[model samples]
Target: MSSQKMRTAQIVEYNKPYQLCERPTPVCGDNDLLIQVHAAGFCHSDLQVLHGQFPAHLPLTPSHEPAGKIVQIGAQVQGSWKVGDRVGVLNFKNSCKSCVGCRQQLRRRHRTDPRFCQSREMAGFKHDGAFAQYMLADPDTTVHLPEKVSFEQGAPLMCAGATVWGALQKLKPDVQPGEAVAIVGIGGLGQLGVQFAKAMNFRTVAIDNRDEGRKLSMEVSEKLKPDLVVDSSAPDASDKILEFTSGEGLAGIVVCTDSIQANAWSLEQLGNGGVMVPVGLPKEKWQFDSSALVFRELVIKGVYVAGTEDVQEMLKVVAEHDITSHITMLEFDDIPGIVEKYTDKAMKGRLVVKIA
Candidate 1:
């Protein structure tokens, strides 16, 4: 395969469609793996990169959620990884291991924070990503895919799944079992959040807006089985949530939509001492009531994608619980169409490209 050339979807300019072109397969570095991508999940963030909404280095390949089999291993790479090993690539390609966050993660054996590392490199944004037949990955940032998880299921876990998993973790040690937790937005992340909340023994309430959103929420409930579903478009959305929980209000709310209105409304539904985790990146600035936050002692926290350990734990949860992402599969050549759909807000769940 030394002389092999692979097809890639390259973003040659901002606000432009990806150009499908052939390029030489990337060479494996000493601590890297050459992955033959089987599936790559399209994200709303990728659309942000394309539309110049997100800061990114130009001429980038924009699919961060990728899963595939290792085709080549670097000489220095070790520990169970070999040719044919199934794996999912993480967004953080590499991080400076000497930073405070890195030192904490290394010493604690869990990720406290590594996003502050000055040397962090992000796939699909700062470097080339898996929107192609083959992509390069650092072994340290890649997780082995369990046999029970299909490539399509494993792909979105790299970003969407791991993201919500990390966000849900923020509620830990505070949110007790049987406490009602609300997941706002029934799209890709919210759907996964509902499953994670249920798996962790939390009473899950799924919230969405409008008739279309209500229909999508119903579909998700049928598949994932949340405890309750709330349509924020209703006149008494907050009232219904409080009534459902017997006036206890939600213990925590995970805001998965990029709509500012949804985020604001979710904050109002939180009970005293409740936490609101905003996982979505809305282009507009958020405007919520400060007095409500102060009087109720509500907490609003932001989370990026998962750390290395979080990614591993997320994968284990998915495998152990038999969780699967609701994804629409398309061919590699259908990237243009998928991007259009995302821009047009037509995507329901997740979209995964069959690269292999």
Candidate 2:
């Protein structure tokens, strides 16, 4: 029997529950590496895929934000990522490696190069993923983790954290130290966003409505010493932003919440030319008047997860600045309940599932 038949997660449809079963441990392709997942975070994105918001090949294994140890590699893969090396997984699947989009975004280093688009395949979305005991990844596309970080702490950095990093970098180029920046929805992605933004020398502020989440946000803020913190639940949250900015307006705002209304509210609160970057893809269209964007001279853009190179550079950034995520660990089989528990509003912070 093929070795892969020893361990795997069975998936029948995009909307169905994930079933755990024995299958061969997946093998690494010529450009790939075989990973033994020690921990894979249950991202909200996974829940989205479960509900069909994100398309996937039927019977697909669903997981992207994973951290683990590398056990084997295909020929031509290098960079000292040998067996037993710590690693983190990013959300991007393989791109054509030659298409414009792939060149521009598949690998962060290729963002400036116009010749690198196109990918051969994708993981989680286009093929099987880390929901199983083993997953195959292209060596060119994986993120290496440092020894200092634990598996759970490194899990969300693979996806949620990378998404936020990409969004924040897009907003604050040469981010002025102490500039005020706001992070919407202090959960899985937002929590890490707060830490990274604060580390970048920006005065990070987190906006969320849940009392527990708000408390968590404040707790993180206290550790980082953001210039100001506000509760989205307050009737006058907008006023609070106004007060905090002293009427000058925020330097930049990232709408991490999935609520279109909250995103629209961000535009109104923006200072002249303030950039509003959306890291979350709401189910429906972004509800807002086109005219609102033109008059304010606002720049609104959305970011997909991130590219291979972005993962590498981001790791260096995280290490140099000491950024990390608030993660909760569960067994590999806990995926079903993990997805079921995330109501539209109750879920916050990243949940890492142990796969070993």
Candidate 3:
């Protein structure tokens, strides 16, 4: 247990910057766990929060993706999770179980009481997140970090990994073991998506624009043995993807980045009856060709943060496959540098903080 209260990063007003201040340790209620944050992943999501783009509570801590060991528990938690269990924190701090998105009330607040939804408090965004030394979590949403996994490897998975994994699973429902699963973009979410696609036995393809992005993406394909890796910036990148699929078109494409032009080009690259699932959020509008969809019968869908069932399946898939993220570990002081210096270059291969 900690000796005293903790210091946390808070954003008191919109676009006003963040503040680090000391505050009393939160009480770990019965259904919750007090995590002594060993590492927290500074995300682009946090950037949105800092800009006040995230739709959430104010005067809240903004670090969400986190991993740490349990230091306390509330009275109502009955899981095997204990004070010493290592766990990964999720983004949906408290997803109202009654809400349609949380899981049709599936990750229900109280299993017996449908009226009582699970009150999972998201670290950083919804409440004071993992930008501090400690975080509060619900056993229902927190994934138990494996003994073999380092704190840094699991931190980003709490958010970035889960979001992409969730999208990939939705795109590939019953594909043959070796069918092609293409992922667009190789940033935070795409990198994990590429790895998970390969790990799940799909013929994985990694696509990106920047040379460095392509270089980093290939690391997963090279090490994990993906079927193909293409830089979408290439003059004939669309045709290259077509070549990999044997002119039959990919079984499914998960567009993890929000570049509208890139995604539209990706749609063009799709073969007959292909599906495009978009995960990234863009500020601008996206235009689609109705004529092409009508002729080819293409399918397009937009995915949200993630469903709770998505979380459950991802935790299992990550565990069963023994997937370890490629992360660059940093200390707490790197936050400002991440925002100011490396905003665009930051991707899945690196985690910007080791909070403990």
Candidate 4:
């Protein structure tokens, strides 16, 4: 509490190493909670922010998934939130209440969908995020971490976990219990998708390319016990998936990789009337056969980070099922190295920075 300055990892330029420096402690606003960060998870989106692929302002503190204890609370923040509470912050900091998405949320008695709102202020993009020792978060965008969940586990849930949870929820309409669902890419997000698919009573199929990814997918398959694991590196990977499902094909496919080829190939595995949810951000545009979609009656949808309600529900599901993230913890000074590893596709699973 006596510290007047805090350490922050900031992006001074595009595709550059984060500059760790000392800055004045952030001031808490009327509706903000001053958090002392315990753990901040490294997300693929963070890499996008660093490479300037995503829309981010310069000289930004880049990290959206954070879990910590509330050191100070704003006077205007009501409800049961208070100092000393363990909490996780979401990427969407705040949304304009007058927007159509916000009004829809109000009518449904749910949290706002900031991604759809035009006046949304996102953490690590529009505002300073949790890559610092001390950062401010809007109380409405914060979720309480249960006693059963550790800070390391809670941190990645903000973005990575919540994203797949939201995507699975969106695909629920097309997916039926006992039917197979394919999760492309076995990295941070795909792993979570595998767990959620199994927990939701769907027979999960994990798909990844050859080499290290295949090995990682096999390991995850053994640990999580998915119904089937498919290596898309094979020429007949889609045929293998169809064979696994007994020619019914997958009820829905969730594409979690940024590879344009993987995204395009995943569509071939979807059954008639099946939906394909693309969650990863690929730099280049994807090309697919238009006749295939028209004849198969396929549905293609894009999903962003979750709304607050989805995060809350996802937390409950995670706790109930005892779902945990595969994370590698690193010290604060290792931020630069971690970014480099992520860019090179050398890092496995999610990486969490131990800030406190």
Candidate 5:
């Protein structure tokens, strides 16, 4: 293949194995950076795109969590960004200034974040993403990878870390430091949620049914681990949490798994006036009794992938606190294997593909 052609693992059809093909390398647009793809991480969102649960352009390359070095900088890009800068790319791109999210006078007051604007370009879903030798990245949502963080680790942080970081941020106004915050479903995002909660000085609790998930919550981070680990499958699970908090229940809960049962179960663990943030995208409808909201005054809010500033701040925390993603590194040749293992019921940690 010529230098202009790059190998890509494309979703040529829904519910099918990825097709490896050589396609012309994407050109750097005026507002984009051409990245020499090194690592791409698979998450639940990738599985959704693969199985056609999410709308996607056909033959799209899959992987929203991508990390690499810039090989070419767009002419219109500002700042110190240049060739050879290691970076992680978020999925959202090209915000339309005319959209409701962008046109709001106050960004924080906007009902929808500009990153979720309907007209925005979404890598992996609407455009070719990192499962390739090269890909285009929007500078707006990209962050530089620290020297302490590797491409493999940075890849998953783009989604998993930023997402949990944003979810935890939502709890700050309601839950004070040293208050109890439980991280439900300790896997890729959950593991990080546990760490980030602790880093934020919340009394962190890790909850998961799988032994591996519980074990991972305590093992993933060197400096920070949950204050407690609870087996959600235990017959006395809710009671255990209540006992730990002195019958107050958790001050806040971040639901990271897509299981409707898990999400519903999390709602029962929150104290009165507590908040719950659901970051997982589940296909099944999430059902909850209205009594909890009315009687407990509980707040449940949805979070998509975090915005650009949040991602950048999340990286800073990861670097400062020595936070690390528990990653399973695989070769680009094993794209199919990556997809298969990601579907495992007990899959723990993030699966990252080395594409270089």
Candidate 6:
């Protein structure tokens, strides 16, 4: 409400640097909440959007993971959402209520269907997103930020945390408490996956080729650290994982990296009747051995960013278990620098930009 104009970082063209410029503040719609963005997370998806891998409207603001205070509430919003409330928003929005996915979501038959509705608009991809000072959020896909979690952490939790949370959920009915679970590629998402698996009472194994990732998995928190960390590049990595599981192999594996090799290898570490949930998107087509899959009765499922209910539970677990993201905080102006950093080497943890 302070100004009609707002500062934004936009992808003016594919494969080019962002353009920092001014745009009119977004108008809050009947079913939308206007957020005064305080903190926004920089994710690999942003890079994908920039490179045209994830097609987007050109000259669009970009950042899907955003956490901030509500400036205005829409009249049609059904919840107790109001001004001054802290919140984090999932990227998918504008669901057509008449669609099959939306109908299932309304009946609670499927919790994750609304986001998959064909008519939905994806923030930072198909629509203007949170890279601006203010953005519109759909109430159906938004969650409250706990007081214990800061805006910086809450921002990344909207995407990275929700993603791993959904992947782990796929293991239910197959993997149980005290069973071994491996979190592959311990970077932004895998590190959190390990912690979440531990919090869920599974014996967790953190797998990564990088020294920083392995170190970060152990350093997350005392209550949520992985029980074991393995070097994925080692020749005996699968042997070590099986050994950790008392020679039975892992009951579940969460693939958090987009590396084709890592995903293929992770499938080999699963025990009989084990579940493998992949949350990462690789450019190349994924191939698996049919004989192994059929003989072992392995189950492979794909999960996207979590639903609103799942995200709420993840935040509760994060707050209760003291799980935190080791973040590199930057200002809004450092958007280009963050993009450059994500290209070559992986950062220790997630990247967050303080916008306000």
lDDT of each: 0.84, 0.73, 0.73, 0.84, 0.86, 0.88
**TM-score, every prediction:** 0.93, 0.89, 0.88, 0.93, 0.95, 0.96
> Residue 338 of model 4: what lDDT?
78
> Considering TM-score, which of the candidate structures 4 and 5 is the better prediction for this target?
5
Candidate 3 local lDDT, residue 211: 69
Task: Give the better candidate number (2 or 6) by TM-score.
Answer: 6
Cα error, residue 333 of model 4, in Å, equals 1.2
Best by TM-score: 6
The digit string of per-residue lDDT tens for model 4 on 82-198 reads: 789999999886678888888887778765666667787788865678889998887778889987889999999999999999888878677788888888888888878888888
lDDT of 3 by residue, 1-356 (tens): 44478877677787765666777787777677888998888777788888878677777877778889998988888778777888886766544655554465455433321113356555576568888888788666677776666788778887888778767766655455688888888777777787788877888888887766666666653546456778777788768877888888787788877888877877776667777888877899887788777898888876655644566567666666666666777667655455654355544465647888
Query: Each model's number of backbone clashes?
Result: 0, 25, 15, 0, 0, 0
Q: What is the lDDT of candidate 5?
A: 0.86
- In model 2, state the lDDT of residue 177: 67
Query: Can you list the residue pairs that collide in candidate 5?
Result: none
Residue-level lDDT tens digits of model 1 in 80-134 = 8879999999878666788887887678865434465667787887678989889
Best-matching candidate per lDDT: 6
Could you give me the TM-score of model 1 versus the true structure?
Answer: 0.93
Which ranges in model 1 have alpha carbons more than 4 Å from their true place? 55-57, 99-114, 220-223, 344-346
RMSD of each: 2.1, 3.0, 3.3, 2.1, 2.1, 1.6
- Overall local distance difference test of candidate 1: 0.84
Tell me how far the alpha carbon of residue 144 in candidate 2 is from the true structure, in angstroms, after superposition. Answer: 1.3
